[model samples]
Target: MALPPRPTPNLGWSLEEPRNEGNSLSVVERRMLERGKKEHSETTLATTRALQIAEQCQEMASSTLIEVQRQGHALDKVEHGLDAVEQDVKEAGRLIKFMRRWCCFQILCCCDCFDPDASMDKSRQRRVRMRAQEEAAMAEGQREFHLAQQAAVLRMANKGTDSAYNGNDAKARSELFAANIRRKTSSREGEALPGLGYGLPDDDQHELQRETQLQDANIDRIGTTVENLRLMSLDLQGELESQAPQVDRLGDRTHVVHDNLTVLAKSARRV
Candidate 1:
């Protein structure tokens, strides 16, 4: 006899249930994958922007360095001009000294006279002493002026050195900033997905870094050369100030010597 007919399997319900479940699972997975892709794209864009910013900073730094160098050159020219002024001053001093000595010598020789009386002898000796004293005073004034000039020079030199050190520090900081940017870019590229071409090749990157380091070294050597020039100008100004007193003293001494010599001449003529 035929077995009782098996209840018709609920194949439709079973197949429909499984299909619905699979579709739901697939939709969730697709959404998750899309979200991941979007995040990755955003990350890549951000990295690119960062690279651009880094490059801009590098350009700015380069321009700053150039400006600093230009300033340094200008300072050098100023220093040269000051040097010329100093030479002129020195020449003037020599000429003045020569003229004074020559005039004094002539006056002394003209006033010289042989005197047999004791009073005349004493007067002649006094004239000689006064001449010696005048010469010594002139020499002392010259020495004082020289010393003042030297001191001023030393102070200016120190100031220039300090300014140079400050410039070097600024240059070093810029170089370091650039180096850090390069390092970060390299690391970011390494972390990025393959084939994204997010950063420079290893060789190019290394070359860039090397070039940056070289620039850094060059900048360090640059120091604030202009600072030295400024210092030189200050030194010259101080030198002039110091000379003023010496000049006044020399003038007063010359006047006193002239008066004494005039009196001696009258005495010799009378005798």
Candidate 2:
């Protein structure tokens, strides 16, 4: 079956790539564009994963509510299941964030490639920056949810609410507890859930935090890289401008010199 067309992003950009100058995109611009398209799709896929996870959470909540209404039987299982749901949610959130940053980066590249207007590009860049901020906010929110889930999981484990959901390998145990819920939801889920931050200890929860810091450091390097690349692009343009005259002179000299050398060799042979 034919698929529906994807809607254009509301980037206020309808300007086609400058193909009239050459082909669809210059080499550098083409790379940037491909990165943008690639990252955008990944972002969309990550977002879909997140949504599916959210729905999983909702279903878990609903089932727990139903169980509560019944007789509070197996409440421990429901709590363990909720912790598992929380873990899955955190995993989805991390992917959403990781993809968002790359998505923002690629959007900037796309804006630069397709738009000659500096003002427009700057506006778009600013928007992407804000999007990055939103991603950061989301990371913070996920941290809170994880902390809550961690506390609940710990409380339940200490009370021996669910021995099957605890141990030195709490992550694996919790995952085992959550597995049934995942199976129930999988048929209704859109795509594969993102796999990240699995089996992290409470002390090791800082892994994603450290990664975020490193990414921030990398963002600082982007400014330096862009300045250098801009200078190189300008240098290339200048070199191309002067190259025409130098190439003409050199080509004329080499051709005449080669012919003269050939003639001189012939004369030498005759002599």
Candidate 3:
């Protein structure tokens, strides 16, 4: 009562034989051929993956280059705008300084020409002018009186041929008129000329002379101050002009350094 057939041992087949190898190679050759084919497939896949990664790196670098170029152009435009703004500001400063200097010059002219208390000074000058006119009129009156006396003498001489009494009356009349003229002149001479104001300005002539001299001095001082301001403003303009190129160069160097750093970063990524 035993089993009819026991299981057969696979003794004829070589160890580790892959399926469908019997038609092409011996046992050892089939094993080596399978390993070689697998290695070739793995190498091909690795090469394809490497090619794709290289293409990706190239695209990234190209895009980065375009972006860096665009940024560089933008930076240059920004620097140009800044330069233009600085120039505008400098010009405006120069114009303001010029206007201020012109105003200062005008003020100096005003100080030289106009008095602060013009009304009071004008009143004093008017009084002085009136006094001068009065004196001139009085002198003219004296001359007229002298002429009248001479005319009276001539009349008396002409009338002497007619009567001595008439000549005497004419002489008396001439003497009386001369006496009246002398009395009026003496009275006016004794009276003091009235003056106005507090102290120095009481004499309008002296005050006018002093004010003219003071005005001249003040004008000179103000002109000197305006000249100094102009010089300082010009100096600042020259400094700004001289430094403008250096500032632009510094900005360019900054962009150049950024570009160099970007190139180095790209190279590192490739490594």
Which one wins on lDDT? 3
Flag regions of model 2 displaced more than 4 Å.
1-215, 262-271
Across residues 1-271, which tens digit of lDDT does each residue of candidate 2 receive?
A: 9999998789865565444353544556657655754564465555555545544444454334333322222332343344444444444444444444445656575554543443433455465567557656665665564444444343432232232332335534544444444444444343322343234333323444343333333333333233323323343354346545655655565565556556555544543
Candidate 3: C-alpha RMSD after superposition: 58.0
The CA lDDT of each predicted structure is 0.45, 0.44, 0.45
lDDT of 3 by residue, 40-95 (tens): 44655555555455444444533443343334434445555454444444444444
lDDT of 2 at 166: 22
TM, every model: 0.32, 0.21, 0.29
The per-prediction tally of clashing pairs is 0, 0, 0
Error of 3 at 188 (Å): 99
Over 147-253, each residue of candidate 1 has an lDDT whose tens digit, in order, gives 44444334333332332322246534543554464555545543424443225345434544444444433333223223334334443344456546655655565
Residue 78, candidate 2: how far off, in angstroms?
Answer: 80
The runs of at least 3 residues in candidate 3 whose Cα sits more than 4 Å from the true structure, single-residue gaps closed, are 1-28, 101-248, 251-271
Say which candidate scores most in TM-score: 1
Alpha-carbon runs more than 4 Å astray in model 1: 1-28, 99-271
